[model samples]
Target: MFAPFAPMLRRAALVPSVHRLLPSNSRSLYQNIIKRHEDMATEHGSPSSSGEMHDALDVLSSESSPISTIPLDPDTDYAALAIPSLQSKNKANLPPLMNIPPQEDPLLHHIASRIMNHGERAKASRTVSQMLLHLHAWTRSPPLPILRQAIFKLSPAVKVIGHKHSTKMIYKPVPLSEKQGIWLATEWILDAIKGRQGGPTLAERMAREVILILKNESKTLEKKEAYHKSAMMNRGNIAIART
Candidate 1:
């Protein structure tokens, strides 16, 4: 009888009616909160847990990539750190020619004057002469020979002051011919004047400043030369009239 009574008491203790039960309101409230949260998630079309986790991982990975890829320490960029020095070294190593000042060719002034004085004739002469100067400067060639060669190349209509008027004496102008020749000539002479070339020394760069000044006076020089020429032509006409 005692054993059966003890077994019944244990069974009663385990049963819900004999136990301290959860309040019905509390249980209902908890269930409602869980269901409401599920409904709200469904209404909002929120991503599932696994999807949310994957998205977060993707974001984290993207943010971390650049930081991990690039070096944090400035010193670690050996190439970047050395770049300024390398550039300086390279600049220093450049040929002394590039650093040289512009050349002072007296011929430039003389040629310029000839151009202004002669107008069409002198202009054409100046153009050809300047082109020749460029060549002479570039090749370090002897002045008179280049001048002679250039004169030979001019059109028959384009005559240097002393060139023969014969058809056999004139040379034709080729297309794209003057372009390269002029470039080479200008750069070469500029280098030579700047002391880059091993040749006969030219006037100092300071003296070259005088040429620039004269270049400004080119307009006045033109008027004087024109007046002189007109007077001479007038005298020639008067002599012819008397005859």
Candidate 2:
């Protein structure tokens, strides 16, 4: 009986110490978990469970301020935007006056003065003559029948005084040399200058018409440019053939 009672007493004494040790271990574990959470938040650069994070989030979610407005440029061409086509057409129709060379021919000067007394008209006539001369000079050989046919394919019928002053008109493709072409062109241009029956004088009308015709006849220049471009592209083949 004494032996059994002694064992029971020792067991009862160990219970309080075990309970005290258990409370200290639990407190230390709780502190360690809290410290680990704080360190993780600091490392990640996140808000540490504070009201300052809420304030920062609110500021970020707020609406942005409006951008500052700027006035239109004073130098902007508003009228051009309204009538662009008409403006472009007018610019296209403007005469290439700068291309006209100065006139020295006494006959052209006299005729220009007699018709309009303007120096500009004389210069324009000279320009027309020079253009025709250049066209003639560009020919590598005497005019071909095919070239004449092609050029005059759309030739207009001409009315001429026939026998007993009866008028006759006909379309004929006559082969012409460079000199003849220049001569004919000069005569036609002169006739155009002097043949106005009414309205503006011949010189004034001729000056305007020459510029308009040059613009309209740009297709010829375009064709020449195309031919040169083709020749340039095939130059290597031409050289090979020559060799």
What are the clash counts of all predictions, listed in order? Answer: 3, 0
Tens-digit lDDT track for model 1 on 1-243? 588699889976665431134455755565566556667777788748445544543443342322336547755878887999999999988866555544645435443443343356556454545555655565576654644343223212211122234654332222223443333333323443454455432323312322332344322233334434544444422223353
lDDT of 2 by residue, 113-157 (tens): 434335577565655354334334544333233223333331222
lDDT of model 1, residue 77? 75
Error of 2 at 90 (Å): 62
Q: How far is candidate 2 from the true structure (C-alpha RMSD, Å)?
A: 34.3
Candidate 2 overall lDDT versus native: 0.46
lDDT of each: 0.44, 0.46
User: How many residue pairs in model 1 have overlapping backbones?
Assistant: 3
Give lDDT for model 1: 0.44
List the candidate 1 regions with Cα displacement exceeding 4 Å: 1-68, 74-84, 96-109, 118-243
